[model samples]
Target: MTYFNKNMPSGVFKWRGANKWLLMLLLISSNQLIAKDINLATAINLMLKENPSLKIFELRKRSLDGAQYTAGLNPEIEMGLEAENFLGSNPYTAFDQSELTVSVSSVIELGGKKDARKNFASTKYGLLDAQRKINSLDLISELTDSFIDALATQERIKLAEESVRLSEDIYESVKRKAKAGAISDVEVKRSFASLKQAQLTLKGEQSKLERQSVNLSLYWSEKQPQFSHLSGELFDFGVVKEIGQLHQNLEKSILIQALTMNQRLAESTLAVVQAESKADVNWSLGVRRIEESNDAALTAGFSIPLFKRKRNKGDLMEVEAEIDSSRAEQQIALLELYGQVNEFYSLRQAAIEKFNVLENEIIPALTHALELTKEAYLDGRYGYLEYSAARADLIQSKKSLIDTAQSILNYGVQLERITAEPIYNDTAQTQGGDS
Candidate 1:
């Protein structure tokens, strides 16, 4: 304390500026570290390979494989040993009182029972496989949705930035005019308010973009989080105009494929029930030894059910009911799919038309109007309020364009998900058919 004088530059004081510079560098590095960057295809691949649900499906497939193997094997193999007093009263003389017998039995299934069982297992396995594919398609759909959300948030963030820049420009203009006595204090105040609002909007959108980026990172490569912005051109909005075979192409939908597979599974189950109604034969074999004899004799036998409870009717009816339910469900899913495709297509079309109008017509007109308003304000032919309103109209037009672009992309993603195809893939042909 005695050495610390007012004129002396202490060690801490000397390093304070360096420490602040280092802190600033650290913050910039931290921001760079947390940014999430992703591309569309890479995101889809991650969802397929890295998702937890896909792992579950793989485990289920392994279990079904085991069951399928077991179904194809023989029913049972039996072995047994027995001890008995073969002689009534004679003991240890010519004939001993004890005897031992061993027996073994193995079942041989007939009447296509084993085949039916194997087929049942195989069908179940096929259903699971189809289920796995459905899972993939579903995951892809979720990825598409997330990807679109990220893109939309990104576009919104850009628009927000633009608004902030425009606001700042307008504010500076008004401030200069006020200093030159060409405008009143009210004009500067209004410009300041608009600038502040723009800044707040930009901050809010940036925060939302950060959240969407975090969500997107879950399905992307590890390096995606470091990306701060998208680098691709925005999707052009328009109809393909090759919509002539729209109804025919509906057959390519993932929802339709899943429904069809489910219906087939129901039909296979009904076949299993019908196969179960038929009688099954059982067979057995055994060997016997007597104390009086030195030889052993083998016996073989087969038996068929003479009569049993006729539960086949109820079982068949149950399977039939399931088939009926599956059919109904399939129909319902088809209807919903059709409705969704139509709805999204309509929305996409409208968004495209609106975006086109804004980009080609509205934006140009707004710019002209804004320029005229600015000139009028310079010549004192317009009030500050009128100039500000015209400027706002231009911003609004740009915002509308951004919103329409986002809407179109959103609908495109939805269509892609429903169809299980790339939205812009022109060469993909439909597969599968009506059952």
Candidate 2:
């Protein structure tokens, strides 16, 4: 289940930034700094080029290549020599009547065992290739989630700055009113406390952003982050397909395809084991010399084991069970994946609904209400309490919008990963050099 995958020779991860692996190599070799903001594509590029786990796939692939090579080989011929009728009874004492023989021998494989071996080896190699790709896709999905988290923190920092400014303006207004005896000292202290809280929140968000940035870089072992920021959109989750259409395409995803490969590999292994059940024919040809007759002749012999199939019953049974297990595992994976797809889809829809309400209705209404309340407070038509409530409502709604957008993006990433549906249309955020 934890099979690792890597970029194939064709570099198929173009969209995931596998094309940038070479560029990453150059930068690392040159000791050049990464000054660009990290994004989805860049993060993938770094993971492909620098992650230790990814490199393991390439090495394992090379080992399977060797297995495929060995599969094509034929049985080796062996030579033997024997002498008889020497140093025995009186008539056959010494070498007086000894018969000498020289022979070349080897097994003649039966039951197409050679071909079965080749097929099994090739299938195993191909299965490894398939697993590598699926693992890569999974890795990219995880990295996307982390990148979105960092981007979300960045958005929150912006919201926090706005909150700080609003808090400062309210505090100044409250002080003016208090100086004129329009409000009590209690209101002044409350406004001052609100300003300090806003500042503290802004500082906390900045620190959170730094930590998230470091987390993103950890995918490639660059724990000390090189990028100043992550450049993906936190609010824009692009378009989502109806769950039905997306689910329909799930079978074609690389993840599901890998299951097919597993089944094929298991079946091929059964073929190899079944072939082994029939022992190969061992035969020999030789030249024999008879001293008594003073003549030479040709001699041949062969060996075939009895009930050879019974010897391999255990192996055949194991392989057959593996095939069945593979089928069951595929069904399990599909079920789990489908469940995840539905869950993420539902979560994404709910988050989107909340975001739209804030973006299109609630936030606008709150902003307008805050403005009116501030004017009323200045004109003595409303109290400082009303103005404070209005201001708090607007700020809280704005922060909620950022949080909800993050949720949408995170859920979108999960959907894209399982469904192979592109939901985060923020690819334009990738930058190579400094940004």
Query: Which candidate comes out best when scored by TM-score?
Result: 2
lDDT of 1 by residue, 1-435 (tens): 131245665653444677678778977887776544457776777667777778887788788889889878877878878878744555633347566768776655545667777777777766777677777877777776767667766777777888788788778888988999987899899989998998898899888877876676666444346566654434554333233345456676656776777777777777766666666666767887876667787867777665322767887788789888888987887778778878887787777777777887999999999889888887889887888898789888887877677677677767766666655535442221001
lDDT (Cα) of model 2: 0.82
Worst 10 residues of 1 by lDDT: 426-435
Clashing pairs for model 2 are 5-132
The lDDT of each candidate is 0.71, 0.82
- lDDT score for candidate 1 against the true structure: 0.71
lDDT of 2 by residue, 308-354 (tens): 89988988889889889989988898888889989988888788778
State the lDDT at 217 in candidate 2.
83
User: Stretches of candidate 1 above 4 Å error?
Assistant: 1-37, 83-100, 221-224, 238-241, 292-296, 422-435
Residue 425 error for model 1, in Å?
6.7
